[model samples]
Target: MTIAVSTIIRPSRILTALVSAVAIMVASIGLAILAGRIGTLGLTPRVLTGFGALFLAFFGFYHGVRIRKILQLDIAGAGQIRLSEQREKRTCSDSDWPHVGKDMQVMQLMPGSTIWPCMLLLRLRAEDHAVRVVPILPDSVSRESFRALAVAVRWLAWQSDSQESSYL
Candidate 1:
């Protein structure tokens, strides 16, 4: 089985939001300064305000880099997730797109579902800290991919059974 590790890229929305926020804040401050609205505090306050904005912008840039650099290894544990056969009609869906290293926050989204859909059972405990996007997108993650991921994680975990793995 070719178990390829998928790398999580920083969400474009995050970068866009951060950049936009910083830009707006800077623009507003610049406008105020241009309007000759400097307070009695003088140049010190302006300098401090500029520093604060710079710090915030730097933080946003660094955060994006951190997100891209973080690497997680999924290792399986002895525990196995159990699914009910009756819940074959229900599909495991998530409220939103899942980040790379986060908890599985999935919900049963099939309407009038008497049982969980069998298609998503392979994803049961397959990925570590990986949430399913099936809820948001019907085919974001494939069943075969999930199953292979599970098997790979379990194997890797077993190899490092003596010590706690970084990604469990």
Candidate 2:
């Protein structure tokens, strides 16, 4: 007899969005500085650089805010993996989130025992997927969910009739 337990992996999109906003703000400020310096070349250069910097700032902020509303990570139980729009079909994959999630798939998500809030790697046995290295996001996911995910993975491993298992 075999019982299947379900685990939902949903890191807060709100949190990621917030981080992205910060990045956008920093980049915008950096671009503004660059424009100010490049303005020394000539009035034409100054106007062009200033316009470009403003465009970058606007584009960055617009995209950053938009992602929060659409970011989706539906990797729950088996066959439940789903990526939202703007995530799958995109030209410039400058946003690291999409690329990061691409390598993940539904599988025996053995997130490891003793998986501290330090590092994590999820691998799929399917022919269509590759290993995804999800680094330590101590605060990206809620503490409880992270622990629960770890427990689920460990439980599956232990139930697989493995003798050399330790999850305490």
Candidates in order have lDDT scores of 0.38, 0.46
**Candidate 2 — what's its lDDT?**
0.46
TM-score (all chains, Cα) for each model: 0.30, 0.39
lDDT by residue for model 1 (96-156), tens:
2122233322222122211233222223223335432211011323455445444554454
Summarize candidate 2's per-residue lDDT along 96-151 as a digit string, tens digits: 42333554444443344335554334443334555433332445444654565455
The TM-score between candidate 1 and the true structure equals 0.30
Give the Cα error of residue 132 in candidate 1, in Å: 21
| Model 1 / residue 66 / CA error / Å | 4.0
Highest TM-score model number: 2
* lDDT for predicted candidate 1 compared with the true structure: 0.38
Superposed Cα RMSD, model 2? 11.1
